[model samples]
Target: MLIKFDVTNEEGDRLKMQYGQKVASKAFKMAALDAFDLYHKNQELHEVIDSQRTEIRRLRNIIEQARSSAAQLLEKTGQGDLIDG
Candidate 1:
């Protein structure tokens, strides 16, 4: 399908208006492309954050295990009082 429209300045010059609209349209397209690129990069960053969260949880579990083992050792050595809990 094809559609067309005519616009004119106060001096009745259509060429000037057409040129201005063309320039404006180009700028709008460029801006839209930049926005899309930024959205894509944001999504990538979110994935990285999710992976880092998983890694932090795993490290926390390891630390808890070490603490439990140390407390058990103190009890066997008759120094359980050294452990707070």
Candidate 2:
């Protein structure tokens, strides 16, 4: 009996496993579990990246508001609008 298994790694390279005489089901199951773990870790990384992006955007908005308010306060106080000074 001959069995051919198609497996691919992170680099998208196809890995071929041949079972000529006997195959262990446990080994195959372990490989599948490892692949699942890799997928789960990738998902977690994507979530972290999304959270950081949201935080960056929130901080940028706050900075913009602070700059605008500072300009308005300077104008109201007749501080000569020293934007660069």
Candidate 3:
């Protein structure tokens, strides 16, 4: 009974192994799971960062508009000259 299996490494190297060989399939599975978990975590973090960036931009626009409106109000109320000095 010859059972052949192929093991691939991160660099895409294929290693041929026979059945009943001392291979760490459990360890490989664990590493794969860890990598998948990290990938998902990074994706979530990126989404959160992107959302915060968008919110920050929106808030900055609102603040700029408010500042412009306040400056206009000051000018209309004759307080612009005081601020200019």
Candidate 4:
């Protein structure tokens, strides 16, 4: 996920004074780069999570189908009451 970092003019001036111009600028650059890296990592993690969810859903569907087939077979053999369906 993308994150926004904004600083107003007064904030910028304060930061510049607290830390010299070079240090302040370097800090800002590093922070921005770190944010970008975090966003990229977050995106990759989300993709993996989504893929896992899809796989889980697919597996659930297969399980439901198997249960349904089993129930049908049991019914044909006059053992339908054996299932808790």
Candidate 5:
């Protein structure tokens, strides 16, 4: 496939530099494919990181809830000040 790009030069022949994408060789195609592969891999990694972040937040919330419940239990049993002292 042809991948044309813009080429602008003042005081130069317009015909010499076409102001659009043009045909690319096998090397260009390979490079483009490699770039695409990297992009997809990066996207996948980002998704995994985001998922891990969500889990971490959830776990943190659970830990906070457990701590709060434990404190309340201790207060009801008149043992809250034992730890504080």
Candidate 6:
């Protein structure tokens, strides 16, 4: 997700006063780079999660098919009541 987060003026002033201009600018640069890296990582994690969900749905479908086939087989073999009981 593309987030719209901002560092306010008060925060900027605090950083400047506490760390001086050079260090403060470097810190801001690092923060921006870190945020960029995190955004890409977050996107990758989401993609993985989506793929896993798709896989789970596929597996569920297979399981349902197997159960249906098993019931059919039992019915053909005169064992339908065996499963119901």
What lDDT does each candidate get? Answer: 0.69, 0.67, 0.68, 0.78, 0.70, 0.80
Per-model TM-score, in order, reads 0.60, 0.60, 0.62, 0.60, 0.60, 0.63
For model 2, where is the 10-residue window of minimal lDDT? 12-21
Writing each residue's lDDT as its tens digit, candidate 5 over 43-77 gives 99999999999999999999999999999999999
- Model 5 stretches with alpha carbons more than 4 Å out: 1-31
lDDT for model 2: 0.67
Q: List the residue pairs that clash in candidate 6.
A: none
Candidate 3 Cα deviation (angstroms), residue 53: 0.8
With a 3 Å backbone cut-off (N, CA, C), the pairs that clash in candidate 4 are none
Give the C-alpha lDDT of model 6: 0.80
Q: What is the alpha-carbon RMSD of candidate 2 to the true structure?
A: 6.5
Winner on TM-score (2 vs 5): 5
In the range 1-85, model 4's lDDT, one tens digit per residue, is 5445587867766666754664556556555667888899999999999999999999999999998999889989998788766
Error of 6 at 13 (Å): 14
For candidate 6, the 10 contiguous residues with the lowest summed lDDT are: 18-27
Q: Residue pairs in steric clash, candidate 3?
A: none
Go through the candidates in order and give the C-alpha RMSD of each one to the true structure: 9.5, 6.5, 7.3, 7.3, 8.0, 7.0
Query: For residues 28-84, could you state the per-residue lDDT of candidate 3 as single tens digits?
Result: 444555788889999999999999999999999999999999999999998998777
